[model samples]
Target: MLGNSLASSPLATLGLAKCFHHSAGEFATYTNVLPLGLNSSHHGLTGGVGTSRNKWIVVCSTTQVETSSEDPKTWEECKEALSCFDFSVEEKDKILGKAFGHIHSPYWTEERAKESPKVETLNQILEFLRSLGLSDEDLHKVVKKFPEVLGCSLEEEMKPNIGILENQWGITGKSLRNLLLRNPKVLGFNVDCKGDCAAQCTRCWVRF
Candidate 1:
């Protein structure tokens, strides 16, 4: 069902260009500028310029270059990084496509996209989820629905939220799995707010 839904998802139609429009003009301008000692005859001189978290970066190469803070990972690279997982090619594509669609969301930024998540960190997340009894299919569905989960801190956001659900509200086993599949975004909710009424209400609802 998740696979079928992804096939018809609007994110499937969106391109990297659309999500990274903020840097389009800058990229075009830098690409056209010839580096010293290179002329129009130098056919392979490719360059890109953009800002990440306010730091300006210029990348140019005759061949492909490594990703840096200034040049974060593309959607393709993000998918490739997840190759260690058991996801099908189509599933990987759909997952990253949905993720790229959220470039401007508070959880992600244009600059962050170029760098992407580290392989080691992603592995930790997968392992943690597996420890909670999530199967490969469940993992795929959760990531597909809320790809930003990839960006959440393992110890800070994910662990604490899951802990609250299990320890405070007794939502474990099948109920926990069902809740995650139904709304993975709940893991990102700020359930630790001390005095906020909204957070208190959320806690109340969970207890009920």
Candidate 2:
């Protein structure tokens, strides 16, 4: 039920990775994502600032004939799309494992992995979390309990919320990291809204 609760929460909704299944066009296992007249270096999923929006877009190369399938029509297609990333088998297993097994439901199958956070993105998030001084086990626990945190933006979401916890609620250093390990979902609250992160954190802290 933790997985289901996370999947439906606003924090998860804000940070959860989106898959290409929502697209109106046909689905292809290896759809070319290049922008019109742009080379691969200048196309989709680029890391450089101003190169592209921080969202994923599925596009077919101009040279390829469009397929007729409206979407990922089968489990195989969904698996292919999700596994097309550059990550290795071990990494894929980790992500998908946490997604499917952690939740103890068929809710997030391969279809969900296709749209879940990229391995690289998840690794970046993990790296930032590590800097917070959490042990490997605690770090894994945080992610396993709240896998949706993988989709959060380092600057916009994670750091800002952590900042609110520290600045407003005085949850600094080890105490903060420990708090997160206890309940990573606390990071999902929008500290920028209403009374902001502090007020929200206050409410949660008292209950925590």
> Which regions of candidate 1 deviate over 4 angstroms?
1-78, 84-102, 106-115, 191-208
lDDT of 2: 0.46
Candidate 1 to native Cα RMSD, angstroms:
13.9
- Cα error of candidate 1 at position 138, Å: 0.7
The TM-scores, one per candidate, come to 0.50, 0.42
Write the residue-wise lDDT of candidate 1 on 89-173 in tens digits: 4565445433433234444433335434455776788788888888888987888777767766789878988998899889999
Residue 165 displacement (Å), model 1: 0.3
Q: lDDT of all predictions, in order shown? A: 0.54, 0.46
How many residue pairs clash per model?
4, 2
Candidate that would win on lDDT: 1
